[model samples]
Target: LGSVLLLLALYVLQGVPLGLAGSVPLILQSRSASYTEQAFFSLVFWPFSLKLLWAPLVDAVYVRRFGRRKSWLVPTQYVLGLFMIGLSRRVDALLGDGQGRGPDVVALTATFFLFEFLAATQDIAVDGWALTMLSRENVGYASTCNSVGQTAGYFLGNVLFLALESPSFCNKYLRFQPQPRGIVTLSDFLFFWGAVFLITTTLVALLKKENKELTPTKEETKGITDTYKLLFSIIKMPAVLTFCLLILTAKVGFSAADAVTGLKLVEEGVPKEHLALLAVPMVPVQIILPLIISKYTAGPQPLNTFYKAMPFRLLFGLEFAFLVWWTPKVKHEGGFPVYYYVVVLLSYALHQVTLYSMYVAIMAFNAKVSDPLIGGTYMTLLNTVSNLGGNWPSTVALWLVDPLTVKECVGAQEQACGTAAAAELCTKAGGSCVTTLDGYYVESVVCVILGFAWWFLFGPKLKKLQDEGQSSWKCKRTN
Candidate 1:
């Protein structure tokens, strides 16, 4: 339990930076950034998607004295902290004025790129560490850590920041509390989280010690060559191959829509404060569902539990799509009912719970199968594949939806008519204005079809494979 808690803490650190960085797109949107710029901001997470590139190196190299995972973990955390602190100082310069024309987008994104790289590297180490720290029977708990800690971190990093930036928050708090200009941006928030990273580092350094025996065999640690060899061997296994396929397809139905909807809401003029306020109900869901799902899936047939839950989870994407369609009507007609917001908020919370539960289940699955010899590389590969498969559609949406919908315009007409007329002209040029739901309609149909096909075709075979492989993998470990 203590080990799981520690792993959870580390994951929270990982989540915080990502959450903070993830806000860039929304921030850009609020500042009237272009669709291209917003999409580019969203793509800043590419490092996380591609962390497998360096994961092998993390596996191959480690200081024996400090510990296999710890050697990397400790340094990465400190560097992450330092980077956050540095980012805090530069937030003003990077973010520029809140208008769309702020700092150089390229440079700001580069800094974000660097931050995500460190965070991704830390994730590789942490995933490796979880496998070694926990016994085979309890390894599934790593999923709980990933789900809960990451969710909490995202709430803090992304949602909390959004709330703070909202007019309501500013009107309520800033009016009374005159903060310094230095504290205006996410600088103070970044610094605070950086302190959290350092504190976690200290705890691990002082209170916990790694078991020498848990280190990969000296042969496994020879270098990158050996890491690749082990990774290749693992990939060749039938179960691992199936697992890879499962991850690649899993998020297609639900995850993609969830990714695009927030931007849709922002584009629709839903105030960040209202969205954040509504999101407060989700905090408990984030913390609670992981515990429930982790416990349920920790049983012998984890994949079966996941399979059973698929139909229900698949509905969330469509529900979210409906919310996107309905929200604007409610806002415009009745002034945005509190009940309407509550219903949408709760629906999203439930969706997040089930969706992320499945996600956690799979991460637990990866943790279970990964060979400790190349733990970092193997696990990182699985997660990277999952993220890539899932993120591909979302990234596409970031770029694709921009041109599909007309929200702004350019030309000499803007000089007299202003931004609104410019937008109308742009829409006129595009031939018609697209509602927020237009993008989601396409996603919903595709996702629903894919969801059913996966369940009917591939799910049962994968479950059987998972069940059979567990016994064999255990025997191999025992030997």
Candidate 2:
């Protein structure tokens, strides 16, 4: 429990930046950011999408005195906290002050990139710590901490932060007019969270003790080349190769659909507050569903569980489009009905269960097949490949949304036509610009088709390869 708590704190600090990143689209949309600008901001998360590049540094370097993972973990937290403090001072200027004073989006994105880089580094260190600290018996518990704690941290970073900044909370408690400024601005929240991070860092350093079951042998410490060779050797295996390919293509359809839906929701005038509110109920769902998945996937047929879950995962991608299509029916001349929020909340819960089930199942499979000889490197490589598959497609989808959307701006406020510069260009050209999601719909349809093909074509083959690999490894171990 102490280890879980420490990991939870570490994940929460990492999540704060992620949450802030989630808020950027809506916050900047109010100030008239274009789809491209918002997409660029989203792209700043590239660090996380590509952290495999620097993951080796965490493994390679550490102080002998403080502890291997701890040395990296403690200092990274302090650096992240400091970055937050610095970011609070600059964010308003970067995101712009709402009176037509345009902020430097490039500069702001650079700061956010730095923040994400640190957070990604922290993730590497935390993962290393978890690998080293958890025992074979407690490995399942560590996975639980990872899913629940990390999701909780992300909720605090993304949903809770938005809720705090919403008009409803401000109006009720802060006695402010019903406006989105709420009681605390984004900068103030950053400053407070920065302090919280430092405090948590101190507690983790003091309380957690490193597990000493595995010591790094000379072979393990040979060089970075050995790690690479070990990783490559695993990839050369037929089962591991198929696993990588499956992970690479599996989520592209779903990721592409999810990318554009959030932007569409923002365009439909749903407040960040409402989205955050709906997300609140999903947090426990996020934590609980993974536990349920862990329980069911604990059996020998975990691969079978994944195969069964894949269809539900693919179907959930279509749900976002269906929800968007049905929005008008639910709203129907009145404001959004309570029923709409309830439906969204329920859908989100279902999404969590389906998505996390597949995720935990994959993690279990990776764990099962991994060679203890390579320590954490084998699983990390698999995870890195899996993330690349999801992230790059999502990045491409962001750019696609811009071209697909039709823009309109005539007699509209400067902040109303997506961006101030776009408004200027549209008004000067004497043509109204209106944006539409025709492209997203097309892309989503294609994604769904691709999802079906990937499942039917490759799913069984990959499972057979996995079964063969696991059986081979067990025989080798017993000999």
CA lDDT, every model vs. true structure: 0.72, 0.73
Clashes of each: 0, 10
Candidate 1 residue-wise lDDT, 351-417, digit = tens: 7777767777777776777666543556767777878877766666556654555332333333222
Off by over 4 Å in 1: 1-12, 63-71, 96-104, 126-152, 173-183, 191-222, 277-279, 294-301, 332-335, 360-383, 406-437, 453-479
Which lDDT tens digits does candidate 2 get at residues 335-420? 58888888888887787777888888887877777777656677777778877777777777776765765555655545335555
Best by lDDT: 2
RMSD of 2: 4.3
Q: Which stretches of model 2 miss by more than 4 angstroms?
A: 1-5, 101-103, 131-141, 172-180, 202-222, 299-301, 328-334, 407-425, 429-431, 435-437, 471-479
Q: Over all chains combined, what TM-score does candidate 1 have?
A: 0.76
Give model 2's TM-score versus the native structure.
Answer: 0.85
Clashing pairs in 2: 19-157, 19-158, 406-434, 406-435, 406-436, 407-433, 407-434, 408-433, 408-434, 409-433
